[model samples]
Target: MKFKDYYQALGLERGASEADIKKAYRKLAHQYHPDVSKDPQGEEKFKALAEAYATLKDPEKRAAYDNLGQRSSGEQFTPPPDWQQRYKTDAAGFDDVDLADIFAAFSQAGGRQRQDMPRPGQDYEIAAWVTLEQIFRGGEIEVGAELPEYDQNGLPHRVAHVFKITIPNGAADGQRLRLAGQGGHGVNGGRAGDLYVVLAVQPHPLYRVSGRDLYLDLPLAPWEAVLGGNIEIPTLAGPVALNIKPGTLAGQKLRLAKRGLGNRDGSTGALYAVVRIDVPNQVSPREQVLYEQLAANSTFQPRAHFATGAGA
Candidate 1:
């Protein structure tokens, strides 16, 4: 359960005035709202955007969240000290908004099984760039969401909130997660739109992802390519050992089935090891002599037929 910081999620300064918060929310909401935009993740961004605004728009609720000491450590967004103080022990002026309703927002729009159904409010969405490791195993995240604000007269307002989102194990890039009732405000008992989360996994230094499979560039020594042995390689799951077959060559890919990134239909991806032979920059004289001998015996021709076909 990641804590969501509405202010940070909405990309606002903590001390931003209500007017500033409202303006920002409108700009972003219009840009990301699914009904109006097509950001691939517009709906999810829109819902989160709206929910953030809803939370921060109300001074009392925002104040409660703000003072709860709900800190943000990447994915640990929480309220500030005395968070309980923000809520009234008993319903007073806000019987319209209560804790149960807030939690229900978590399921307002439902799951992948049903997104087209009319919701209480408009849904919002956004993309999150995460590390490959986080995808291999479940983890939490912090998202900066922008929300709208308004006056008693029903005018728009501005403010930002940060929220922590949970990432499930074996999640794929572009995969979505729904947070109900996190979308637009309900009207006449209708539920608000659900908040959807789409993941954008960043490329790892040692891993290249293709579908559910991961590829690694494993540098091999000249001897290792000829003699073959186990070598260290990195994968989305973690570092692992890959066996090098004797006489291995460049462009050769070996598969570690089901060792990739996400599940195929329901499990996990596969891992492929791409072999690359390394040439020593500072070779020993003895090694250089050996290479010279090897080169003498090498009958390999790289571009043997270009001379015959001179069309260009």
Candidate 2:
């Protein structure tokens, strides 16, 4: 038989502690697990890692394997005569038998104990699109997701599930809401994993969001911008009156406090009414006459800066 160095297979020293062994196994297992790894040799490497872990993780099996003494890997060797006596096994023709098979026999005789251990299910994250109104009102929204489910034989397959998830008041875009015991099914009575719902706020036609603040284009007539007046505007909650200041420039933002998205801390974000000055495309004859008179009498030089060096 050839000697197999279990420690070297797991990339660990012979004196590695139990915790070190478990940590190393987990890291290597994740890297080489055939389902997720792209390496061509991942399956074989994973099997080797599993075999090594199965032996080293057990106190009695590790002691028995260590008694074989240190030797170069793959070197032709034979176990000492006392090895069979210690393990209370009588076997003929040890040659050509794999090292994994040797330890597997011990596990099998122990009633396949590891298979009965509880294993937690996998966690999942899915996205759910929400509306600004939903965030403001804080209510339940239906979400559908395709998640992996394990069958009776422990084979994983995709399954669609619908969940009624609550939209938190003031929930921001890309915020994650956790639902416990809603992920993949656990094995052997283990706790099921959690499901994370990532909120993707749907784009609104009239409003833009930043953090919890709301912004809307507030179109104002030329007279309203120049003379200042109160106008009605829409908010997520309802319509509210907003005051416009005289000489308000285009693109100026008018803030309305406590009129935006609700916050988790019982506060609310500001609503910004962006000013947009508008003018009538056509004018009545009487209106044109008034405009012509104002143009003739007015001394307001709107383009005065164009002639001045200040424009340069």
Candidate 3:
């Protein structure tokens, strides 16, 4: 067989780090994936990338491959005399088995394994993000997944499919949804593997999420903070009124009990409205007169500490 430069296939150097290898593989996989790639040779390129990733991702396999030294393309190649004894027993992980067919084809071409037996397909995992609104309402989410398919002639190709997944209320980050028989196709009538969607909640500009709790900045006018009143506030459910107490200071947090994210067990978390007092940057003539009158009449002394320190 012709020599294959695994590192060159991944566009990496001989001493590339594990993380670098994975990054390169993922980029190439997305670009050459049969389902989404517009390139006519996408399938072949994907296969090559998969083989390179599979061989290099494992420490033992990588070391063994590296021991063979540099090789030129199109040159006749053979493994070392003790290759089978040294590396044959090393196995690839489930995640890297997407290209098992290519490896099997090589083995079969060399007359190693029985051709009649069937091999099960490989499982796949992909990272996905869900909107905070979707989690709050809890409904169906459409996820587009690209996967490899095969023609009647047994040639491999890629296809994209939309899967409707039901997201539960209060679905937190790092959650996973498993779909059975949705991953890679099996060989010779073997059953297909599973697909896993690892989920993360997208960041929201209005609120910060922590577990089931939600925190938001509640901006209040200086007079509103001092006088206290019912203020309209926004929540995941909708706008609601919150009663603020008199003399409420900045940075004070007000809790809306059981108003945060809902759980599957019928429980809900509390929402915290953190107080932030705002002052007018430019005061009108009337406002300035009112502020001057209040400053003369009001007994509130905000600089009392500084006065006491100066006195001491």
Candidate 3: the clashing residue pairs are: 34-158, 35-158, 35-159
lDDT per residue (tens digit) for residues 1-312 in model 3: 345788999999999999999999999999999779999689689978888998889776677668767887555555454533333422321122223343433342334458556767778776678878778888888888777665443433356788888888668878889999998777767899889987878899998988899999999999999999998999989999999999999999899989788887889988999999999899999999999999999997788889668752
TM-score of each prediction:
0.54, 0.58, 0.66
Candidate no. 2 TM-score: 0.58
lDDT leaderboard ranking = 2, 3, 1
Q: Write the per-residue lDDT of candidate 1 for residues 201-308, one digit (tens) a residue.
A: 887888888877788877888789989998777665567787888989887988888787666357777788888889888989998898899899989665566767
After superposition, which runs of candidate 3 have C-alpha atoms over 4 Å from their true positions? Answer: 1-52, 55-119, 188-191, 306-312
- In terms of lDDT, the poorest run of 10 residues in model 3 is 89-98
> Which 10 successive residues of model 2 have the least lDDT summed?
86-95
User: Between 1 and 3, whose TM-score is larger?
Assistant: 3
lDDT against the true structure, per candidate, is: 0.67, 0.80, 0.77
Mark the 10 consecutive residues where model 1 has the least summed lDDT. 91-100
Q: What is the lDDT of candidate 3?
A: 0.77
